[model samples]
Target: MELKDVDLNLLLVFHQLLMERRVSVVAEKLGLSQPAVSNALKRLRLLLGDELFQRTSKGMEPTPYANQLAEPIAYALSTIHSSLNDKQSFDPLTSNRKFTLGVTDIGEIYFLPRLMVLLATVAPNVTISSVRNTAVNLRDEMETGHVDLAIGLLPQLKAGFFQRRLFHQQYVCMFRAGHALDKAEMTVDEFCAADHVVVVAAGTGHADMDATIERKGIKRKVKLTVPHYVAVGHIIGSTDMITSVPERFARACVQPFKLRYVPHPVVRTPIDINVFWHAKYHRDPGNQWLRSLIFEHFSDQADAAA
Candidate 1:
């Protein structure tokens, strides 16, 4: 089929369907009636001579053919969008786009304060929405343009993603200011003997809080287990349990939660914290501007290495 036979406008609907995997969502995103979106899909199906997507209990599951076309089509559309908007410079002061960011709870605590302060003056009209990085299908959300960017130690954002290092953070032992382990130094044995709060920081890929301890035949007395780092400062402050947290995060909680920290005995390589975005929108002007803003205010790769 020649390009003339195809309604390129249908590609927009097609792309939205591929990302959303639901007819209603694609319609809403494209500002069309569900039947109009369905009609576009039908036309594309006829032209391509294949069922691009089919309804299933798990939403619109893409055909192998549809999956095959996803990348090239996305690249083409992004290029066209870039060209069309090339002359219209992104003015942060006047643009009111809402950028959705994917972040863990700990990330929200560590990154948002400084980010919002900078945005308040620079892009007062712009808005920010946040989704849990651990939420279902976050990668697909980011790829589809639902979630614009993510920041953290997410290992899953590898392929089809672009990332820049913000900083490297090592694990530190955090506890109440008056806890028993509040001392000049802590040995591995004392660290093991103390009651621990096992933080299952689910999407950061560092949830195995005991891997290093178990490597040395050390068994920890886990007094409590929690799914997030948001309440760690509060819980550890009011209890005798000590926990391991990222160094910067610990520093942030120090004064607010009346916490103290010492070097963690387990001694592992530092984890990199980075800002991540889908390669599909890497060149989009607004995305570019926000990422630059993040890098400018938060990135400390050079200082961390030094």
Candidate 2:
């Protein structure tokens, strides 16, 4: 079929239908009637010479041909939208934009609350979707646009990536208030002897703290290992376990859980927390605006430290 035979607007309709999978919902979103959407779908099917969608109990399921066309079509649409955005200055106050951010569980603890509060005043219509930064699959996700911005200790991203350091973080040992260590001068021996609640990493399911300490010839008696930092507060609060966490996160938990942090018994290496994005989106107006806002909100140390 020729380009003259198909309306480009139908591709927009097709893309939205692919996303929503229901004609009625797509119509509502596109401000068209359901019949109009159906007619557009029929045109799409005829132009492509394929039944792009097949109706089933689970809404409209895309055919294999549709699946094959999905990525390039979406990329084209995104390019067009971004091109349009390039013609105007990004006005955060007037734009309704949704951004996906990949953050470590610790980052979510320390940053999300404050960031949301700031956005409420500066860009009320903007929305955020946060994803876990598991170290693994982050590069792929960012390159594919599944993740727009990632904030974490990602030293492994070396090429085709852009990054700016938010802060340098050191470790601190935390325990519930009134714990035995709080009353005594804490030593390495005492810290290692105590039962520990460690956060296993999101991707590997292994606690990196264990390896970091082991390299220094120290071993803690780990009684519990969890997959996220959010659970550490309640676990440490109710139990006799201690955890070593980033200073920022440890400080944030102190007030709410009646926790106290001391210097890490073993000398720990400071990790760089960075904001990373794919090079493909380097010049995107929306991405650039969001990156600037995030850096302004979180970082004060140095320029492009990572």
Candidate 3:
């Protein structure tokens, strides 16, 4: 059992087989005959000393050993492929390219701080700028290549873009640290009775949340209104106001703004935060590196889906 005894090409075949399951599908994807794929799987079985994959009505399914090897093997293959096929061979340490990302204001608050910190050490020359995803021209900008990537709950970009799920975040009720609503649990009436600072963020498409709440006949008292989430923290922290926000935003703002949060009394669907890029730059090395960095650092489902 040695690296010399294994054909690295078989790993690529192994990777594709794990993805497609059927030998014919794997052969078609890899531009080989079905027999070639079957032979590669046979070699993989002998080299690894495991059955690897078994055929069933569900198509080819990985054995326990194959499942055990999947993560490390996929990661290794991706790293090797990126290393070999990097267009212009991007070097993060030396590349001075600037990348602009489209994100909402809350996106900026949650994504940029740690990103900048990481760049300062590993990619000091690289620069990042974030623009509001609410911009009317965001889609055109991304298509025409002005915006390199986008991250947030962007339902607008789902149609014609490549996306990877980073995590799913739930809504939380946020208020000042010492506010009365800080209790472990509160009733719908208690939540609705509190003075609220409402944020009418455009393009976030949260009307469904309102519709759901309305259907439940639960309504909150509105004490103030704002156009965005940036000021929600400061306004609620200083006043006896409460608002429902994404869990990460609440977590990020809680300690710094001296705020506290409890799970929303009303059950709400969690939003998926994803990293999106246009197909035009899908193979661009710098784009790939940046996307990988974000997905690696911010994705909560990395083990499950990465």
The TM-scores of all predictions, comma-separated, are 0.70, 0.67, 0.69
Best by TM-score: 1
Candidate 1 regions off by >4 Å? 1-88, 301-306
Worst ten in a row by lDDT for model 1: 297-306
Better of 1 and 2 by lDDT: 1
Model 3 / residue 296 / CA error / Å: 0.7
lDDT of 1 by residue, 211-235 (tens): 6657768788999999888889999
lDDT string, candidate 2, 166-191, tens digits: 77777888899999887544798998
Error of 1 at 272 (Å): 0.7
Best by lDDT: 1
Which residue runs of candidate 3 sit more than 4 Å off their true CA positions? 1-87, 302-306
Residue pairs that clash (backbone atoms under 3 angstroms), model 3: none
Candidate 2: residue pairs that collide: none
